[model samples]
Target: MGDELIEKAQELKTMIQNSAEYQKYDSCRHILKEDEELYRKVNEFRKKNFEFQTEGSAENGQADRLAEAYADVLGQKAVMEYMNAELILCRKLQEIYGLLVGDLEFDLDFLQ
Candidate 1:
């Protein structure tokens, strides 16, 4: 059901937000260590869901059109959230890398 899917999506969002890995990215070092795994899981889930949707039928025949629609919406939201987090991590990395490489451009812009 749509309601159940939405609830599950919300629960997943809460879990992601409250995860230790998500909270540990206060510095570039942490981000660098954790971002890859986080992004990989997100991307893998997105790909798997997309592939499942494309398959057009469920083994148990329980996947109705409405259920598919609900799942698609949930998947899209999850992907978007993952992308937003990835972008934030990338920007943090760029700032740190620039500082390390003596590229003052990011420092000037970021510090402002």
Candidate 2:
């Protein structure tokens, strides 16, 4: 049963890799990396965005700063395309995971 689950996971992984959203994201990622400076900026912005999200609340104009950084990077065509592609791919993964777990029952109100 464990081996069967692993095989099914690999098949799902392959299917995701072959998906249009993943293909576009992979292409845009390569294109984005062609510009090292832009890629660096994008990574930095991603770090800041992640921090902002995990913090759960904005403090001392952090939201504004993050927005400004986003606007700056997104003004570049490559960055905008890469970000959009990434978002689409992420949403696809989220949908897939949601479906896979939708039937599972869990109670964890303590975490909140």
Candidate 3:
């Protein structure tokens, strides 16, 4: 049964990779990777965004700064397209996971 489950998980992974949302994300990511300057800009933006998130309320105006930086990155066509495609892919994965969890009908309150 354990081996069967692993096989099924592999199949699910393949399905996700073949999904249109993932395909778009993969293509956009490849384009971003091919451009040295764009990749650096995106990576910098991501690092700053992550810092802002982790800081939470620890730093005033950090989020605003991050937002302004993000807006500037959005002004670049490649960055905007890649970011949008990545969002779509992430949402698609979230939907799939949520559907599976709903079907399982686990009682989470019991854990508490």
Best by lDDT: 2
Tens-place lDDT per residue, model 1, 1-112, is 9999899778866765665545543333344336576546555555665666688545555345444554544355444555556557557656645665674444466666
- Misplaced by over 4 Å in model 2 are 59-61, 107-112
- Candidate 2 lDDT tens digits, 45-74: 888887877896566678777878579787
Whole-model lDDT per candidate: 0.55, 0.89, 0.83
Query: TM-score order of candidates, best first?
Result: 2, 3, 1
How close to the true structure is residue 78 of candidate 1, measured as C-alpha lDDT?
A: 42
12, model 2: CA deviation in Å? 0.4
TM-score list, all predictions: 0.30, 0.89, 0.79
**lDDT score, candidate 2:** 0.89
Better of 2 and 3 by TM-score: 2
User: TM-score: which is higher, 1 or 3?
Assistant: 3
Instruction: Kindly list the per-residue Cα lDDT of model 3 for residues 1-112, writing each as its tens digit.
Output: 9999899889999999998999989998898889897798888887877776786842788767667867866677778889999889989889988887767866689778
Give lDDT: candidate 1, residue 34: 60
Instruction: Single out the weakest 10-residue window by summed lDDT for candidate 2.
Output: 56-65
What lDDT score goes with residue 27 in model 1? Answer: 39
Q: What is the lDDT for 102 in model 1?
A: 73
Clashes of 1: 0
